[model samples]
Target: MMDAHRQNRLRALTTPVVLIAILLIFVLIVTATGDKSLARMAAQTLIRVIFVVGLWIFVGNSGVVSFGHAGFMAIGAYCSAWLTLRPQMKGMFLPDLPPWLASAEWPHLPATVVSGVLAALIALFVGAAILRLSGIAASIATFAFLAIVNTVYSNWEGVTGATSSVVGLDRYADEWVTLAWASVAVFVATLHANSASGLALRATREDEVAAAASGVNMYRHRLLSLVISGFFTGVSGVLLGHSLGVLNPNSFYLGITFITLAMLVVGGIGSLSGAVIGVLVLSVLIEGLVRFERGVDIGGASFALPSGAQEILIGIIMILVLIIRPSGLTGGRELRLPVLGWRVRHSKQEPQSTN
Candidate 1:
């Protein structure tokens, strides 16, 4: 009986282990590929992965859907852009800046850290306010926050260049840099998920009233998750700015926010591995479909999709995923290396005998 129980436990561990191995192999293969454009796409995908993972830390662990992560991203992007862009040109561009603001030159690393910290601070305030609400109200409040942020970013010319896209940022983000940051974000999120505070956060997510009855500080946990998520999302925004070499208020608008949310939902809201898978699958599908349309010829003539076809396709896929598997592809499964051809862990118990 004990042996049988042990076998079942081992069997339960198999799935995640195998998944981890496969994921590692996939990463290695992509990194080794000699295609520069593909490499660049992978790098961009990594940045998106970071953003989605950040969302997962809050939405997945806390069961609170947030549409305002883009606001945090915008904060990070603008902060990093302002810090790293040529200080000499600030007078030409941001003419109204204070004398001190017009003459600050910041290196890359410090600028990125500062950007992340600022975003975290913003999230601390926003989360404290919105986390007090429950259910749909919380979700709606988050969406409203997104709209408010967009409006401010669009019209705030003194700091954000108003509706115009901010330009001339130093391009320092690459695949390796993005990957390093992504790894860090993933590690931090995973650690948080397993810690005592993470358990309390998960309890609050599972049942807020019950958790509160048990003396868990629900609001505090939610706020902490939001702050942590904001910091990483900010880092992703910095990477995005550097990657694109420009910053635009419109880039972090509703469309991008929804897409990132979709990525998290389709990946699985309760698991980190799900977030990574969702981003990989969506990014590949969108990019590949667009490329296919660009390359295909129909009836002896070249064919190409309209500029926004990718968005439409992604939307369709999201709808299908929601209808078919709302919990996401991995559900709550983690990606980990397998032993003896098995993945995932299962609790062991003795089987009931009919005799």
Candidate 2:
């Protein structure tokens, strides 16, 4: 019995453990190559993995598609920048900032935590009202929220650099840094998926009316999921800014919003495994397309795709995937220990036979 309990515990952790192992191996391989470009791509891919996993926390469980997480990312990026930038730099570029923020400079780690919390706070506030409305209405509201954030940041010259890019940030978030965060995101997502709120939210996703009848507080669970989702989404933004050493409002706009969503949908938005795998698969394809656009050498001949062709090709691939496997690459299932699953199946059958 003790052995069985221990096996059950190990089985429960299988998903997150496997996901983190994959990320670790990916980083190790990239490091072994000693190629700067591949390392950079790996870093960016890890960031996207965090973003998609964060998105899955809400969308996967709630079955409500969101278009506003990019805005949360923008908020975190700028907030971390504000906290970490030199006082002189902030004064020069963002003279309009409050006195405390203008003079304050902080380390990246705490700033990351604070930025994530702030993003979660914003999500909590916004979701309180938005989650009240069900279905498409809520989705539209989230989109509107994103647009508002973008417009405000774009025109807020003194604080966010307006239409200009904010530079001179610390570029410390490399592949290893992002890999750690990606692991954390996967672990947190796994916990949430197994939590009561996550289970209830998924129930609501399956049948809203039935869940409500069963006494699941739909609004509460939805809001909780969104808050959790916003935190990691925000942290991913912080990593993106630090990795590139620049912050731009437009960087967190429609392009990232749709691409991340595409990754989640392509991977199987209903499972945490799908979120990570989707990012990996899509990132690799995008990287390959980018290399092709730069021209590949074949037997002293040059082969190159047209500039911007990658986007079109990726779009086509996503469409094909959706057509063929709408449930996503993972089919809404997690990575589990196969033997453990088999044992559970046999156990159920054994009980049936006894009856």
Candidate 3:
């Protein structure tokens, strides 16, 4: 009995273990190749992992599609810029700042954490009202939230630079730094998915009427998931800003919102492993398309795709995936060890037969 239980526990661990190992291997290969562009691509991929997994915490478990998360990301990116940028630079670009925020300069690490916390708090506040709705209504509400955020940031001349890009941020988010955060995101996501709230929220997803009958507080669970989701999504934003050494309101708009959603839907929004896998697959394809646009050298001639072909191609691929496998590439399942699962089932059968 104990042995069977141990096997089950080990089986439960296989998904995250495999995911983290995959990331470590990817980094090792990139480092061995010593390609700066590959490293940049890897860093961006990790950032997407963090953001998509954060989205998974809410959308995967609660079965709610959100278009507003990028808004939280915008908040975090700008918050990090406000905190980390030098006081003198802030004064130069953002002259109408409050004395405390204007004069302050913070280190990157703390700024990242605080940025996430601020985004989470905002999620909690907004989710209190938004999570009460269900289905398409809820999705629309989230989209509205994103629009509001974008508008505010675009017009907030004194604080967010009013459509102008905030520059001079330190480009400190390299591959290793993003890898650490991605690992943390996977860990936190796993922990949340296995929690009681996660389970209850999923129950609500499967059947809202039945779950409510079973005493599952859908609102609370959904709200909790959103808070957690907002945190990592916000952190991803900070990483993006630090990596590029720039921040702009437009960066966190519809383009990113749709692509991340496409990653989630394509990778299997119903499964955690799907989130990570989706990011890797799409990021690689996008990078390849970018290279093609830049003109790849063939045996004797340079071949290049037309600019903007990547988006159209990606959209077609997404449509094909949806039509072929609506549940996503992983079909909404975690990575599991078949042998361990068999052993566990066999062990239970053995005890029943002995009795």
| Model 2: CA > 4 A from native | 2-10, 342-355
Q: All candidates: CA RMSD in angstroms?
A: 4.5, 2.4, 1.9
Query: Over the stretch 1-355, how does candidate 3's per-residue lDDT look in tens digits?
Result: 5787578667876778779988899888888999999998999899999999999999999988999999999989999989999998898778888999998899889999999999999999999999989999999999999999999999999899988988999999999999999999998898888878888999999999999999999999999999999999999999999998888899999989999999999999999999999999899999999999999999989999998999999999999999999999999989876787888888777744563
- Write model 1 residue lDDT over 182-289, tens digit each, in one string: 877887887778767788999988888899999999888889889999999999999999998888888887878988888888888878888888988898898788
Backbone clashes in candidate 2 total 0
- Candidate lDDT values, in order: 0.81, 0.93, 0.92
In order of appearance, the predictions have TM-scores of 0.86, 0.95, 0.95
How close to the true structure is residue 99 of candidate 3, measured as C-alpha lDDT? Answer: 96
lDDT of 1: 0.81
Q: What TM-score would candidate 2 get against the native?
A: 0.95
Q: Which ten contiguous residues of candidate 2 have the minimum total lDDT?
A: 346-355
Q: TM-score ranking from best to worst?
A: 3, 2, 1
Worst 10 residues of 3 by lDDT: 346-355
